[model samples]
Target: MNSKTKDAIQIILVILSILMLLYSIIYLVNYYSENDILTHFPSNKKSEDTDLLTPNEIGDSIGGVLNPIIGITGSILTFLAFYIQYKANKEQRKFFYIGLNNEKQNRIDESNKNIDLEKKHHITNLKIFKSLVSSMLNYYISSSQNIKDFLESEEAKPLGIHLFIFKTDSSYEYFNKLDFKNIYDSIVYSFQNKNEDWENDFIKILNILNFYEKLLAEMKNTYKIHSQSKAEKLNKVGESITQEIGYVLSDNELKNFDGIVEFLEIVYNSNPDNTPVLPEDQFKGTDFERLQDEFFNKYLEKLHMRYNETANEKYKSQLDKFSFMNKKIGVEKFQTVAYTKHLREVYENNFINQTNFDKVQEFLNKINIS
Candidate 1:
């Protein structure tokens, strides 16, 4: 039963016991007084009725009154003692019940705590995955900046004027980046574990990852990119550049980049100089192709490392799986925000998701995604 119900029952039992005990005590006192159980000072049993002249009648009447009081009192005491004993037994039973109930509740509470811990880590780990993705993408785009300008200037897009800054490895910048990653991971882990001090950080990371995911998906769609072929489609996204036939094609529009090179070499060998055939880039010319390749490879390497790194960090403990998952959740959420703000802007505006925009605002309150 519930605490309130148990308390009410206990109260009723105590009251009944007290009443019975009081009745027993009162009855016993009256019975004894009437009987005159003063052992040392004995009462005279012989009675003299001066007017009626019947001593026996007087004594019989007195005895009749005393005997009933004595009997009633004894019965009351017996009943009272039994009732009180019953109440005490009831109390012990109730105590046992409470202990059992508390044990059950404690188990449930611990389980819930374990569940919460897992959720927290999952979120954080997800965020980490996204961050790695973002880092790879950023590296590729930034690395290709000079090549983009060169290609465009060669009249592919036709503007010599560039508008973006060139940023190399500044010690401070590298330090700041490392610090940010560490802090982000720490917060995610702490929140998942329900560390009281990290409550605010946990909430912040959650909003961050959600925003990053929305950004990346929207951006990818906006670019209208398609894979090279049916076979290529099934390949991991990171391997896009190394595949012989790429979606990004040259001018002759040959499916395979290597095919273009081989064909050109064959023609050149046949006719040394009669409008010589060109390699892939000159024919289907993209200036940044070579540079893009370098960064793209790095990006793939980064993505592959995630599986190994995360598994190792988790220690592959079944007992700690929940904690690991909770970290992932946080990471995923953070990644959403990072991608949305950083990468997607190149093509479209998807700062917030359609379904969760309102909730996103509520979670982050007022902050710049950029």
Candidate 2:
């Protein structure tokens, strides 16, 4: 039975026991008063009332009535004592279960805390690795002569040189004189044979590029997991409070108050749109290609300006070609203001030291690929 029912039964049994005791007391009082026991006392021994029994007989008569009532009362009292003990034991068991549940919850919370701490440590290590990869990429891009030769070759068709001298018949002589075909053939032979220093450098650069792609993917995944965990914890907190109070705090507002989102953005190097600033897919053409494109484009721009100032007939066809390509490609692609502002902060705060900062910045500036 339920505790409430058991309690009610116990109370009823206690009341019945009290009433039985009171009945027994009243019965004895009436028996003595009605029988006039004083009439049979030693002081009135000379009385010849044969109907009055001896004192011993009256005692036996009282015992006959009281004995059964006493046994019944004692049984009720005994049962009441055992029932009270059982209730005490039940209450103790209830408290024991409560304590057990509380201990289990504490253990679960401790495990969660350790897991969160481990994730944070992992994220920090990934950030360091990412920075190292970026530095290595910058170093290779700036120093690799194989990449430079490839850019200038006819096969690569360095964008600036192509625009300046290969667009029209009038400038074909300048392109032919550069002997880019021979340069292209030599680069191809060396790459295929893998016997040149430039070839080795090229392979190393490719390896670094591949590593960078994987690193970016891993970093993005880790950051996403960490951010989601924080969001879930915040949601849990919101759920624990009253709905009216929870509604007063918007999700974004709650995140702002915690500062976790902002901290994650900074740590993960994300743009304001929540996209990673240096996205994994960003290196599809490779940073080297972007660098080559930017370099040649700048070269053509300067050449065009020089030709305009000098009014030289010798440069007329080339400048015309430069103008057409410049117009076609659009100068807007060359604007690096946004990249410079964002990356400057990123490098200063997280990735690059002052020693490597200029090289990294220069590499970033030359990239036009979105």
- Pick by lDDT: which candidate is best? 2
Q: Which stretches of candidate 2 lie over 4 Å from their true place?
A: 37-51, 131-370
* Model 1 CA lDDT for position 85: 73
Q: Best by TM-score, which number?
A: 2
- Per-residue lDDT for 276-307 in model 1, tens only? 45544555322222322332233333333543
What is residue 272's positional error in candidate 2, in angstroms?
A: 62
- The lowest-lDDT stretch of 10 consecutive residues in candidate 1 is 154-163
| Candidate 1 Cα RMSD after full superposition onto the native fold (Å) | 25.6
Where model 1 places Cα greater than 4 Å from the true spot, the runs are: 1-64, 150-370
Task: For candidate 2, give the lDDT.
Answer: 0.48
TM-score of each: 0.31, 0.37
lDDT by residue (230-281, candidate 2, tens digit) is: 3454334323322422332344432333223333343344545777756655
